[model samples]
Target: MTGLIETNETEAEAARKAEADAAARKRVADARKDADELAARIKVDGPRIVGELLSLARECAKQSLIAKALNAELPEGETPVPQADIVARDFGAEPRKDIRSRDVELWVVADDGRIVGDQAAVTSSDGITGHLHVAGAGLRWRCARRKFREVEFNPRTFTDWPGSFHELIRLPRLDGPGALFDGSLLTIEAAAALDVAASVKPTKRQPRPVQIELIPVDPTWPPATAAAPTEADANS
Candidate 1:
């Protein structure tokens, strides 16, 4: 009876050890699968981050005009301020996708009571491109206090092409009211002649992502092909 009891005890111990080993192997396998899924997501959405950042920077630059248009309440002792035409820029796109979301303020102080017409200065990075002809979809005006009016279009539009040197330099497919010019329309012809988004360096804030991917356009693509339609003027 004593010998039998010893054998039973040894068997129980072996069974427990086997179970522990099996559980450890399963844990390793699960961890690897989780890592792979995360990696795949990063690979797919990482390129567009820079374009989003550029868009954010452009929107922040428009604060002065936006505040004036919205009739925003200044500080208690703030003087009555003049409003100027708000302008945003298309700087370039960057590669990193890990982005935080935040609000950017665009403000322009005008000596005059009303806004100045066509008061925008813009600059582009060698890696980014925005022409007067075709661009990404964005509103000419934004709802005050809700969100920024300027935007960076999705970089996935260019995924079907040759990638950029790295992530930060992708040329995004962008559209703004300024891109298309109908030479026939009087207003269109006048706008086409302007080069503000092309020339001025805008005030920019940090880049944020609404969706985790938070990527921007790839710089190397022919941006016009991926262009989508957007509102020309929000005030309209």
Candidate 2:
């Protein structure tokens, strides 16, 4: 009789628990339905307001990230300042790709709002090359492509080839002209027209990859097919 009584009590408890769960589920469903009805009442403004709020949140997050990355703050008594000129680079160490720019700022001064020279002082990206004027340094020139070799000119030897020597200097597939550097620089036209053999000096330690000499531009010789000039050729 006691076992029967206990079983009846357990069944009653389970029934009550099931009823409670159903009520809780019904409340959740009703709450979701009410939210949907409320959203439907202000269909247009609701979406726009939500979108704007999300955008504002995103902007706040972005500013937070920028502050963390830069660790920036205004000095005491100074107002916040915005910069128009900003450049992006690879953020971390061990960068593989190098950032290259021909239009570079050569000089800058920050005291008392003073700045000198315009961007035009440097050559434009259009074909024209600019050379640096470095005192007492040999000018290094490279072929625009990975061709047979590079050419270096001694100071003040960059001039038109007079074709005085018997040997010929040949540079194949010339890709415009490169920069020339000396205490006083020369323009690209002046540098390209340089007498290669006269300007290039034989180095004692470094082996010359390609020997150059000046030969008369002959109709008999094929165009762009000249070899390195020998001692006999030079003597001739």
lDDT, candidates in the order shown: 0.42, 0.41
lDDT (Cα, tens digit) per residue for candidate 2, span 1-236: 99999999999999999999999999999999999888675554543453343333334334434544454665677644421111111122332343442433332222222222442333324323333222367742211111122233333322233321111212211112332123124333343344443332222355659988988877675555878789999999
User: Which residue runs of candidate 2 sit more than 4 Å off their true CA positions?
Assistant: 44-236
Off by over 4 Å in 1: 62-236
- After superposing all C-alphas onto the true structure, candidate 2 shows an RMSD in angstroms of 41.4
Give per-model TM-scores. Answer: 0.28, 0.20
- Show how many residue pairs clash in every candidate, following the order shown: 31, 5
Quote the positional error of residue 145 for candidate 2 in Å.
99
**Could you tell me how far off, in angstroms, the CA of residue 129 lies in candidate 2 after the best superposition?**
99
lDDT tens per residue, model 1, 1-236:
99999999999999999999999999999999999988775445533453344344333335444556556767787765532221222233445443345554332222222222322332224312211211365423211111234544444322122211121222332222232222223232233243434423233445775665656677665686876656865445
TM-score of 2: 0.20
Q: For candidate 1, report its TM-score.
A: 0.28
